[model samples]
Target chain A: MSPLAENSGPDIIAAVIGLGSMGLGMAQSMKRAGLDVVGYDITPAAVDRFVADGGRGAATPAAAAKDADIVVSVVVNGAQTEAVLFGPQGVANAMKPGAVFISSATMDPAVARDLAQRTEALGLHYLDAPISGGAAKAARGELTIMASGSRQAFDTARPGLDAMAAKVYELGDEAGKGAAFKMINQLLAGVHIAAACEAITFAAKQGLDLDKVYEVITASAGNSWMFENRVPHVLAGDYTPLSSIEIFVKDLGIVQDMARSERYPVPLAAAALQMYLAASGAGMGRDDDSSLARLYAKLSGAELPSSTKEPQSL
Target chain B: MSPLAENSGPDIIAAVIGLGSMGLGMAQSMKRAGLDVVGYDITPAAVDRFVADGGRGAATPAAAAKDADIVVSVVVNGAQTEAVLFGPQGVANAMKPGAVFISSATMDPAVARDLAQRTEALGLHYLDAPISGGAAKAARGELTIMASGSRQAFDTARPGLDAMAAKVYELGDEAGKGAAFKMINQLLAGVHIAAACEAITFAAKQGLDLDKVYEVITASAGNSWMFENRVPHVLAGDYTPLSSIEIFVKDLGIVQDMARSERYPVPLAAAALQMYLAASGAGMGRDDDSSLARLYAKLSGAELPSSTKEPQSL
Candidate 1:
């Protein structure tokens, strides 16, 4: 059946039940793609902003999700997602039967499996569709989605999926695979950024000009997406939190938990986690993820860039 | 005066002693660049290869250095370097007057400075010129040389340096800076390769098809030079040594020493060092650095591609 047919049939409207960086972007993308988007957030400003952006805004989850064809939960983690969908006055009951709920947060695979089973019991489809790409890509509808679900769920969610992501990796006809893939991506991304910071700061301490090191590394084999993206923040000394140190504190924690559960020893991931923890503990948690480079500078007593420099860190 | 004029007038012919992966490649590059290159090694087979490749092969360091303008030591480490250049029956006393010595191994920067001072006091010029690029690039006379020396030393070694290196980073007119730059490069190269291993192995553990993961990552920002170069060896399950794990064990050791002396903490480098150490301890020191992924697989109890699957891990 055509994806648009679902809305004309018994399918309800679509609810984007968060208005954070990623959620607001996805909501705009869904609206742009002609989905009936209803956005809600705990803060009135978020709801108002969604309304200002041509998406319908509601005061509460129940109001937004009532009769919704798909409720996309894009909150911080399992607890926030659970509260939004299954908490007191939550949206699960309000979402129409046969509707699909796409969860796009990076969470534990076990939690994903559990959520999938719970949503399935409600006669709803649950597609674990954790996403990548930062805020800009999200707003442009160019994110990458790692998704898994039954064929019916895939069919039910494909329109919104296509609207929200540029690349959709259909991991399997199951829930946890999406979460697993997202976790793997997170593990590498986090480690690479932290390693870039360590290497650059160490270069600086060795008396190599930070800018020269960045230039050569970017041109050489030592470069990574994270390295190319994050080292400028070090050279510019800007620590604006595009992604916060706490994000890694959370993400690498997920990696460590997964590895520990599987008896997998990931020493590099573990070491990188400790460095992020150090950054967060040093009152830079709210600063940009590039602030982790500050941890290297702090430990080495090396000088980093300051506001006198340009503001482009990423 | 032109480099040739200086070399021909009271000229010193330089012998590169080692003729291993880097040495033979460099000796050939120097020969192609028209330097009076003499290549030496303990292994007659390697010496034969150097001779066949159009380099002058000498039986002993003394014979190689008797009329040498420069002695380029390209051995494994400081000990081999010192043994070939400054030990009993060393080439230091055998070298013609006003000759230069260029140390090309990745050793402690302190050693570079010490050697430079000692050699200069002995009325010989010294240029600390550490080379980069693998054997393939080296053989094509396209290596990157991190070099530093006094004006006379630089002038003296310019002929040979120009012949062998595509990029010569004139770090400073000091001895240790070249070694420092090399240590920084090693820090990034080592960590990047290990991080790539962690990433690709994690993808495998997540059940994403290895080939698919390679294709996607190569297209994505996750790609790095090391990732692109080394991952194929893992996919093929061929661990034949190209750049061996033992190489990192030594290079990262130099980085660690550099960091420790400078009190610069390098958690990422440290973590990567441990993985190489594990690979070495597992008796894979002689295997290609790509075998690092197998170390990750063994630690995680994940199945690696076997000989039945690909026959080799190169």
Candidate 2:
């Protein structure tokens, strides 16, 4: 794959249609790269944050995309992405002919393909670009992007893409492949997080020291990226929703749907989804995914470290 | 935890009871450190190999431990450990008074405690020392050992421990605690391996490039130590039992038993265990743990890299 070019940004008008943790950062990154970047979000404060960060604020996606060469959609999932592109006040009709839309939502690949088809039919390019790295990486404009699109789509989104990402995997010349790659990532991430929680809580149940467990497992073959990152929350007895249980609940649910449609039994991903569902159902939908340890503790009467600082109710 | 001292080996007599892959390497390491190391195994060829490696070979645990100050049992599980210590011609009675028994078998903590008590009652010490790092680490004398025992036990076992292990976590001053830590590691390891297999196979089902998935994942948050290490075997269509599927079936089975006894449900481990069992039932038990990917390929009809070179029958 030819590397996408950087900083055509000086002449590009970029629209970022969401300004949550990730989107806000992307907007600032685009602006920093010298793009005339305008941002909009459902949350006014989020858009205002981007504006305060020196981005132009728009009242709607249509207004954001009206004169934009590239529109970046960074909503939560496929439905919101669809709404951003085609719902009332959507950007599709407002986008200039031949302008590109880079969709950074994680969803079923089939959904990604459908959105790309609809977007292309409107004389616009759609780039399926699902991102990795956390919000911190996003804020630093160093996200890892799994992207697939036509050559023209990549060309049009190149400036904004280079501004917001450290690594861009050009996965295919179609929209669905990047989303498929991202789903594989989500399936593993969700399962690993759940496995880490299950393992750590079982350690607690066995009366093994949690801190020592962390030290040992990290150095051992048992370690995972999620375990290393998320176990600190359990060790500190902090269940702040840095990345909430509901995120996996939604992502793994999509994996289940995608696998089901293919008539594939994804036992591990399915099991992980149920645990996330259980965590969410237990009012931890918004808690850190590591809250699975707390759920296991509550269910098994195991003594995890108690925290007076955490909220008692969801 | 006081660091166990190195290579007091010139004067120490160390016996390794079980000359398997791990045991043979450990014995060689002990011999290299100047210990008078004797080794034994049910399989005579293993003992022959150890003997060829400049160590003495014995026909029984008792014979191996007879003049030894430290007896290291590197058998598969608690039952083998128990048999080595108390079966007909076992080491507990054969070992010198005040000698230490280092049990490196992964087992239930309760069994470890029980074995420690029985050995101590016979005027010997038992160190619950479960080892990690694979055969290569063992050969390099750089294994990570999670160990616990009385001060006297640690003192007696120090030379052998230092000779063989790069990092020895002195987790507690009792026999069971080290086993507890080891089981926690196993729980996560088993689950992570199963999840990695599930993920790569699912990616294959999605028709995503397996090599690309590996490239993207190891750099992403979805990565685990297992995924990075084991996926290559899948990519090469090699299922060489580097670490067998049966290993996780056994480890996760142990985890399930441990969790169940505490009435703690480890759904992810349990789910992962089911996948390992499925892989094993499909006659991949003795195949590498990554064979779960092959199992997924079989059940879902996904085309993972295939090998005419791989065995087709159990």
Top lDDT hit: 2
Instruction: Using DockQ, give the best candidate's number.
Output: 2
Model 2 lDDT per residue over B1-314, tens place: 11223223357889999988899889988887778889999899998887776678898889999999999999999999999999999998899999999999999898999999999999999899999998989988999999999999999999999999999999999889999999888988888888888889889988898899899999999999999999998898888788888888888888889888889998888888898888788877887888888888888889988765846543
Fnat, 2 decimals, each candidate: 0.61, 0.90
- Report per-candidate DockQ: 0.55, 0.80
Which candidate's TM-score is highest?
A: 2
lDDT of model 2 at residue B235?
95
- Cα shift from native, residue B176, model 2 (Å): 0.9
lDDT string, candidate 2, A1-314, tens digits: 11122223357899999888888888878776677889999999998888786677899889999999999999999999999998999999999999999999999999999999999999999999999887888888899999999999999999999999999999999999999999999999999998888888888887888889999999999999999999888888888778899999899999999989997888888888998898889888888889988888888987888766856443
Task: Flag regions of model 2 displaced more than 4 Å.
Answer: A1-10, A308-314, B1-10, B308-314
lDDT of 1 by residue, B105-184 (tens): 88888888887787788788888888888898888988888888988888888888887888888878999888877777
Clashes of each: 15, 0
Q: C-alpha displacement of B242 in model 1, angstroms? A: 1.5
List A-chain TM-scores for all predictions: 0.93, 0.95
